[model samples]
Each structure stands twice: as C-alpha cells, then as structure tokens.
Target: MLEQSTRSERGSMTGEEARRAVREGRLSCQTSSLAPGYVQGNLVVLPQDIAGDFLRFCQRNPKPCPIIGMTEPGDPHIPDLGVDLDLRTDLPGYRVWRDGELVEEPGDLLSHWRDDLVGFVIGCSFSFEEALLADGLEVRNVAEGVNVSMFRTSIPCAPAGPFAGPVVVTMRPFSPADAIRAIQITSRFPSVHGAPIHIGQPEQIGIRDLSKPDYGDPVAIRDGELPVFWACGVTPQAVIAAARPPFAITHAPGAMLVTDLKNSRLSIL
Candidate 1:
C-alpha cells in the first residue's frame, strides 16, 4: 500500500503505485487530484458477447469514449494500464446495472466477475485536468473537492448495436484566457478526452440550466466565466442505462481507476 503518512509522499507516487493501493482495497474513494500527473480512467465492464459492439461504438464516438486500454474477456489485468491493475477491483466504486437499471453500488466488483466479462477503459476528465494544472490553471472541481459536473447533451453519439444515445458532457467554468489555455493543453492529450466540445452557452448544447447538473456536483459559476464542456466518459454509462442491457458495469462517477501510465504519456505532442 502507498503510505499516506504525509501528503507529499501520497502526492509523489508514480501512477502505478497509486493503482496498487486501490487494487489492494487500501484506497477506495474519489481519485480526483490524486496521482497528479498520471492518467485516470472511467471503466466499463460488459459481457464478451456485446464487447465487440461496444468497442465499435467507442471507435465511432472517440470524443466521449476514447479507449485508453481494454482487457481480454475474463481477464482482470490491463498490462498497459498497470501490471497490478485488476479491472474487477481497482476502481474505487462501481455501478451494477441489470437490464439497464442500477441495482447495486459496490466498492469493488469482485463477486460480479464473470468468465465472459470484458473491461473497457475510457479516457476521463482527470487526464486533462492534470494538463490544465500543469500549465498553472486552477481546476475548479479539484479546488472545490467536487466531482466534475456532467450533463446529458443534445449531441448524439454514433450508434453501434445497442450502444446508442445522446452524448453526456462534463463542465468546468473558466475565464476566456484560461479556457483557451485549457483547450491547447488538453488538445495535446487525445487519449484523455481531447478538448472542449462546446464553450460559453450551456443551452447551446441542450443544457438548459447550469445550476442543475444531470450527474456529479454543480460548481459556482461566477461572473465572466464560461462553462466549458468536454465529451465525458459517463456518456457510455448513460447509454447503457437507457439501452437496459441485462448486465453492465461502470466505474462510479468521480471514483476512477488510476493507471500506471502518466498523463504526460498521453500527450500527442
């Protein structure tokens, strides 16, 4: 386990060290602002039968669903994410959906593991958040200790089999200058949700109200800041829920899987 003796040590660990702690059940909580420069992922587990279709959906809709890494059916580890990574147990919390409705919320998904289950890791906002912070921009969600605000948008994702629905997005309010910097910084990391899909007007993306988010926490939007929207990994979960597959699993929002890969490694340039 990574010692939490001091904040510095906890903050200094390589991305893999942090994942090891999560896999051992030593840390099962929000990963926000942790593993400062490493990639953090949103996980989706599905039966082998439908995994191929889901992959196609992701391929067609890369913005909301970039595939960072995936595991073979029934396999728990994604060597690319971390040698110690176990899809069934590494994430802090999981949502078990049966026939498209959330039925159980578990800290880990060990018991639900099936012989035909496959795990897909979607790039998350956390990856880009690291990039923003590195450039000295304050990430409001981290500063406020809240999950990034997410919403079901008017944008429709490319349909693949049963995986088709309106796209969902996460919001972060920023000044014009900072928002531009965020775009530039995040653009360099396409694996972690590349860049903002929309900016300024929430209603422009079918988000009628900024104060009421469909998922996660609502942050204060002060004067002069625009709500920048990024295609969110949660879009898959929402689609799965509406499609109502017999069984599906997703990492609980904000409670993500920290991978061994550094956020810097995700940069395109």
Candidate 2:
C-alpha cells in the first residue's frame, strides 16, 4: 500500500506517481487538478461481447467519446498510457454498473475484474483545460477547488447497438473575450473534446439551471460571464445508464485515469 498523505503532497507528484497512489489505496478523490500537465482520461470497461457496439458508439460520437487508449479483453495494462498502468486500480475511483444501473462506486475494481472485460479510455477535457490554464485563462472550477460542473443535454447521441442517450457536457464560466480565447485554444485538442459545443444559452441545450449541475459542484456565473459547454467524457456514463448493459464499469465523474502522455503532446498546433 502506498503511504497516505495530504492533498498538497500528492499535488506535486508526477502522473505515474499519482496513479500508483490511487492503485495502492493511498488516494481516492476527484482527479481534477492533480497530475498537472499529463493527459487524464475517462474509463469504460465492458464485457467483450458488447465491446464492438460501444466502440462504434464512440466512433459515431467522437466529440463526446474520443478514443485515446483501448485494451485487449481482460488486459489491464495500456503500455501507451503508462508503462505500469493497471486499469483496475490506476484510477482514483470506479463505478460498477449492472444492467445499466449503478451498483457501487468502489476505490478499485480488483474483485470485479473478469477475463472477458475490455477497457476503453476516452479523452477528457482535463487535457485541454491544462492548455487553457497555460494560456492564462482561468478555469473557474479549478480556481474554486471543486469538480467541474457537468450536465446532461437534450442533444441525442448517435445510436450504436444498445448505447444511445443525450450528450453530457461540462461548463465553465468565462468573460466573452476569454470564451473566445478558450474556443481557439481548445480547438487545437480535438481528441480531448475540442471547442465549445454551445456558448451562451444554457437553456437552449436543456441545462435548466447552472447552479444545480447533474454532476460535480456548481460554480458562480457572474454577470457578463457566459457559461461555455464542452462535450464531456461523462457522456458514456449516461449511455451506460440508459442502455443498461448487463455489466459495466466506468471511472467516477471527475475521477480519472492519469497517463504519462503530456497534455502538450495532444495538441495539433
């Protein structure tokens, strides 16, 4: 077991180190601002029997389910992600689902691991959020030390097999000028959910209220600031819930798989 320590101590560790901590039970919390500069991902593990359909679903909806890394059936190591990465434990948290209904949020998936399960790692906004912060744009959720606000939209995802549901999105409030810069900065990292899906009207996207987000904490949207929405990795969680697969596993919202890939490497220009 890794030695448990304070958040401040964990914050200074490298992505690999952070993942080790998670695997050893030394850390289990939202992975938002931790492991800075590395690409973080949303994870979805499913039985091989249904993996093909889910893969197609992600292919059809690239914005919300961009593929970053995938593993062979029952294989936990994604060498391209991290040399020693263990899919069942590298993430800070995991959500177990049965027939699409959430069963539990466990610290690790050790007991649940099966020979037929396959892992899919989708790109997450944390990669681009790092890019935005590097450009001096403030990410409100990070500044306030909270999970990024996420909501479900009425926008329907293209159906594939048993997977189909509304798109899920994460919101960040920014001044008009900053919002423009954000769009430009994020556009360079399409694999991690590029550009704003919607800029100003929250209601237009079916977000009834900014203060009451469906996932993560709500941050204040001051006057003159617009809430910018990005297609989120959490979309798969919604798909899993709606599709009700016999068994599935996913990283808990805001709790991600930290990889050795640098966020800068994900940039196209």
| Alpha-carbon lDDT, every model | 0.85, 0.90
Clashing pairs in 1: 100-244
Worst 10 residues of 1 by lDDT: 1-10
Q: Looking at model 2, which ten-residue stretch has the lowest summed lDDT?
A: 1-10
Model 2 lDDT per residue over 117-228, tens place: 9999999888998888889999999899888899999999999999999999999999999999999999999899988799999999898989999998999888999999
Candidate 2's displacement at residue 209, Å, is 2.5
Encode model 1's per-residue lDDT on 200-246: one tens digit a residue.
Answer: 97887799998899998989987999889999988988888887888
Per-prediction tally of clashes = 1, 1
For residue 223, model 1's alpha carbon misses the true position, in angstroms, by 2.1
Error of 2 at 229 (Å): 1.1
Q: What value does the lDDT take at residue 57 in candidate 2?
A: 98
